[model samples]
Target: MTSLFDPLALGDLTLKNRLIMAPLTRMRSQQPGNVPWELNAEYYAQRASAGLIISEATQIAPLGQGYPGTPGIHTGEQVAGWRQVTDAVHRAEGLIFLQLWHVGRISHSSFHPDEGLPVAPSAVKPSGEVLIADWTMAPYETPRALETVEIPEVIAEYAAAARRAKEAGFDGVEVHGANGYLLDQFLQDGSNRRTDAYGGSIENRARLLLEVVDAVVGVWGRERVGVRLSPYGTFNDMHDSDPVALFTHVLGKLSDRGIAYVHMIEPRATSAGGGDTVQEGVPCSSELFHPLFDGVFISAGGYDRDGALEAVASGRADAIAFGRAFIANPDLPERLQKNAPLNPYDRSTFYGGDARGYTDYPALG
Candidate 1:
């Protein structure tokens, strides 16, 4: 049986174990430039024991940002800032991947360049409120539909971001296509109501994501690129008429591309209460979609040690990504290896905070 501690070949890199630190949005980047700083470096370096540490979701361009203090890969300063983080993780003997992201309609105009409206595949308005630059909750506004000609610009941004990640000293890059973000909005039918080549059918709907993947792969090659997806996610008021069909095609295409891995969020994680709240009887996205992808399969959700062990041992998932658990336990892999009790995480400081909930968690002595 494969244990969580077992080493696994993941693309060009071999993970020392199957415990991955999921890309968590902490919104703590330095202001004015959304650049990562020394504090961010310390937070990631503290959790360097994981098999792989996927950095917080980083916007590929200024327009890609949706929340305050989130880091970006677009500017020279941002790249330099992330270099500090990558250097720290490497010095700690850890491998890390930067997750390239675009929030689309999940954003408010205040975060946009010149306060422009958020862009999406359609002009639909999402149901929830978004966190703006001032840390206030504002209702989501109807986003501007991207002109068909404008999409190539978006694809180019992803490629540019991948190159920036490389320059920043990351081992690889993961395209953020999950959790009702920009790519997710394009994938599902509820948010993407377009008549052009970018939407309408399953193939068309997945076109942008695949194109972004191709662009990123061009920069990092197939072995160093991965894509994250959330099939049954309802967060940000996202839905699909036929999720299985949509993701089956998406996963199959990604598999055919022979990329590094496909990270998926289990349906339970996007349940009504919260991402960490587990809903009973929800199907595991990895179990349903892992077989569709030929590369490394990583599953993220509300997973305990026993559940993670079973998922890997049973071959349902190749590795497991932990979010909230990793937030509260920097030495999570060591603690799990010894079955030690985990420190409870504070929800209040999960976002837009200082070192309190970010790096203040004590490791096992």
Candidate 2:
């Protein structure tokens, strides 16, 4: 039987342990474009002790951006900034994966090109809110529906971004197809209404996300790729009547991809924003998300050591991911192994800030 600190092989990437650093958006990048900076290098390096670290969600294109201070992989400067971060982690023997993200309509027009409305699968408006900048909470901009001709462009953009992530020094990339983003919007009928080949049927709606995975796999090969999904999450005004049916069909498509792993956030778990919302017009529980994917599964949300052990022992997941714990405990793997007390994360400085709630967290002595 494998233990929490057991050596694990995630395709071409071999890890010293199975405790993964769940992708958390701290929004520490530069403004106007979310370009990375020296401070980001320091933040990631401090947490380099993890077996694997999935860096924060990075926008694949300008219109894909949602919140301020999040990183982007579209430009030369951003790539250069991330190179330093990757180099720092590598020097400490840490393997990192960059998450490719498209926030869809979970954005404000203020952050877009010419301050225009953000785009989504359809023109439908979603309930709920998002934090923009310091002291700014706005209603998600009413999104404009994408034309059929524009679908392939977004797919290609994700491919280009995956190439950029490789060029930027990441060992691999994770496609962000969850948490009510563009991909999830397409997967769920509540936020999508298209008569084209890209909507209506499960296979049609799953087209965009699978295309994204295929394109990234083409660039990075299946072994160096991964995908993140929140089947039970009701985030960003997202919902699906039959999530199990949707993912079961989708996961069947990924069965032969030879990808590294599938990282899942349980639906009813307390998300970064708070509790799970799988009600009417809300996304359902993610606790039963394990059977969707065929490869290695990494489960996350509200897990401690005992819980993680149980999941692995029960054959539910290959690994466990922690968000807040990683923020407050950079040496999380070490702390877990030693049975040491862990620090708490400060919620105030989670997005857009200096080093206070970032690198200042101490390790166990």
Candidate 3:
């Protein structure tokens, strides 16, 4: 039996186990630039027991900032701040990857640098709400659409961010293409209505994501790069007319490039809540996407220990990512190794908060 604790070689890095720390969006950073701090370092270091840690979604540039207090990697301060995190995690014998993010239209003027309009593939308003700096709930605002000429710059930002992540001491970098972000915004036809080199066709719509992969892989090498994609999802008003085709074409692209891994959200994974496989919003079906990606596959969303085991046992996935469960249980692999019960996460503190729910969750003796 291939246990979750088995060492697995994912590209250049060999993980101690299969339990991956999902890239969560915890809007906790210093203001002005949302630069990372010592606290961020401590939080990540504490969770170092996980086989691999994908740090919280960090904005690539100033325009990429979606929420206040979320970290940024576009500058020197943030990179220096993150070095502490990587150093700390390494000290604890952990492998960590940085998740580069751009929220696209899932933003409010309150979160923007100039408080002007936010950007997306189109000016679509997100269906649900968003939490701001004060941790106040508010409706999402309509965002300005990105012009065709502006796309190359965005792709360059992802590449530059990946370079910064590597310079900042990250083991690898995962492109945040999932959860209704900029890449998902374009992949999903419901929001992306562009009629340019970057839209209308699946190949065209996939241009940015591919370009991003090219750029990041160029800097970090294919062995140190990964990408996340969420199909059939409803978050941030994202849905594609034919997600399978869009991603299958993408699968061919990923195949050609030799990316380190593809961290995909399975049919029932959510960005929030414990990884328990909840069926909601088209269920993010991955049956169509699985066959396409021929790399180290790490599936997350909603998966408990047993479900994760099933995924690997059935030969469907190589590894599994645990979000909330890993959040509450720092020594998650050890707990699962010993078949210990996990501590329940406090939902109220899932967003912006201190160490209470962030790092205060105890590791069993």
Please, what are the lDDT tens digits per residue for candidate 2 over residues 73-113? 99988998899999999988899999999988886776765
Sort by lDDT, top down from the best: 1, 2, 3
Clashes per model (N, Cα, C within 3 A): 0, 2, 7
lDDT of 3 by residue, 1-365 (tens): 77677888888789998889998877778766788888788888888988899999998976677776889999999999899999999999999999999888876677654747779998888887877656688888788999888888888888889889989999999988888888888877888888888889998888888898899999999998999987666665677888778888887899788898988876565544433448765544445566777788888877888888887777677788988887788888888888899999877777676777887889997
Per-model TM against the reference:
0.98, 0.94, 0.94
Prediction 3 TM-score vs. true: 0.94
Worst 10 residues of 3 by lDDT: 268-277
Ten-residue stretch with the least lDDT total in model 1: 271-280
Off by over 4 Å in 2: 133-135, 273-289
Candidate 2 or 1, higher lDDT: 1
Q: Choose the strongest candidate by TM-score.
A: 1
TM-score of 1: 0.98
- lDDT of each prediction vs. the true structure? 0.93, 0.83, 0.83
Tell me model 1's lDDT, rounded to 2 decimals.
Answer: 0.93
| RMSD, every candidate, angstroms | 1.1, 2.6, 2.0
Task: Give the per-residue Cα lDDT of candidate 3 at 241.
Answer: 85
Residue 214 in model 2: shift from native, Å?
0.7
